[model samples]
Target: MTTYFVGFFLGLHRICDQVMAIKRGNYRKKKVSSTSWKKQLKSWSIRIVVGFFALSIFWVLCLKFINPPITYLMIKRGFQWQSEGKGFKIEKDWLPYDDLSNNLKRAALAGEDAHFMSHNGFDTDAIKQALEKNQSGKPLRGGSTISQQVAKNVFLWPGRSWLRKGLETYFTFLIEIIWSKKRILEVYLNVIEMGQGVYGAEAASHYYFNKSAKSLTKKEAALIIAILPNPRQWDARRPSNYVNSRANNIVRYLSHYEIPD
Candidate 1:
């Protein structure tokens, strides 16, 4: 009987040793697997960074020559309207820089960004003023320069995110570097939303006044520019008293505003 007990104890000790050896082997394999996963993650991150920079350079170079057929905002609005069964279609007519009315151009500069010709991609003074106003608990006003507007309207969708703002800044810099002031204004005039479906000076003129952009009168141009702050809400054809007042102010500014030659 003592011999039988001794044999049982020896068998139990051997089983425990085998289990511990298996656990140690599994722990080593787990450590190796964790290290491999981290290496793969690092490799993928490097690839993404390289790919992003390559694509950004390509996009900037291509836009220097080609007009964008559609913008992110155009696509977003189209999808939204379609989902709501509004049958809304984007109306755009790409006119050359020469074909656009000079009055329209001046009106835009006066109403939207008076320092369009001088600023790089930002208006520092305007930004400071806007910041001060907002900090004082006043209504927030946009300090975006015409160059920034062109960048956002041409290349980006509407959003108030850090990522979107960062991308906007990058594109703004790229456009300022790659495009001349005339080209920037040309794109801005052609792509900015004028009405619900109207886009560009030519389309806005045709929709609102049944005339060509080149023939828009000074008042017509001012009225068109007046609704730009909220084109979706304000109608140039049926301007509110407030809109008319703003248009008059813009017209007054137009006398002093100079278009770049």
Candidate 2:
């Protein structure tokens, strides 16, 4: 009877060992599968990021040679106007860099970015001043340079978020690298909003002064640019005292604002 009990005990121990081994094997399989899935997920994530970078670069490169038929801002504005029950109109006409008025170019530089030809894509001093003013709780001001503005107007949506700012910086760097100073200014003048429904220097010149862009006088150009900060509210044809003041200041700067050859 003792011998029989010992054999039974030994058999029970063997069965327990087999069950534990099977569980260990199953755990190893699950761990391997989880690791493989994680690796695949990481690989796909990298691929998606690479694809986006490539596409963005291609988009920027194409714009260097081709004028964008429309922009993200234009679409947003159209939708916004329609939603608000306001009639929507987008007035934009593409003009070559040389065809644009010299006075308009100078006014743009003086009023928007005085150091357009010298700076890379950003103006450190302007950014510093803007930061200080915002810290002091003054009305929100922008320190965006021409290149930065072009980046936002052309490729990005308007926002003050960190993500939008980061993308703006990235596109500005690309524009400064891929395009000439003349091209940058050309694009800026062509895409910048000038009135409620008017876009670009050509349209604004026609809409406000009833003249061609190339014929825009210094004062006319300055007045148009002066109201650019709030185009929908201010009319260049009937400018307020503040607008006139800003235009006079811009005109004064134009004497010293030289466009790069």
Top candidate when judged by TM-score against the true structure: 2
lDDT of 1 by residue, 216-261 (tens): 8889999999999999899999999999999999988887877865
Model 2 lDDT tens row, 240-260: 999999999999889898896
lDDT of each structure?
0.88, 0.91
TM-score of 2: 0.95
> How well does model 1 score by local distance difference test?
0.88
lDDT of 2: 0.91
Collision pairs in model 1: none
Cα deviation at 48, candidate 1, in Å, is: 1.2
- Provide the lDDT at 238 for model 2: 96
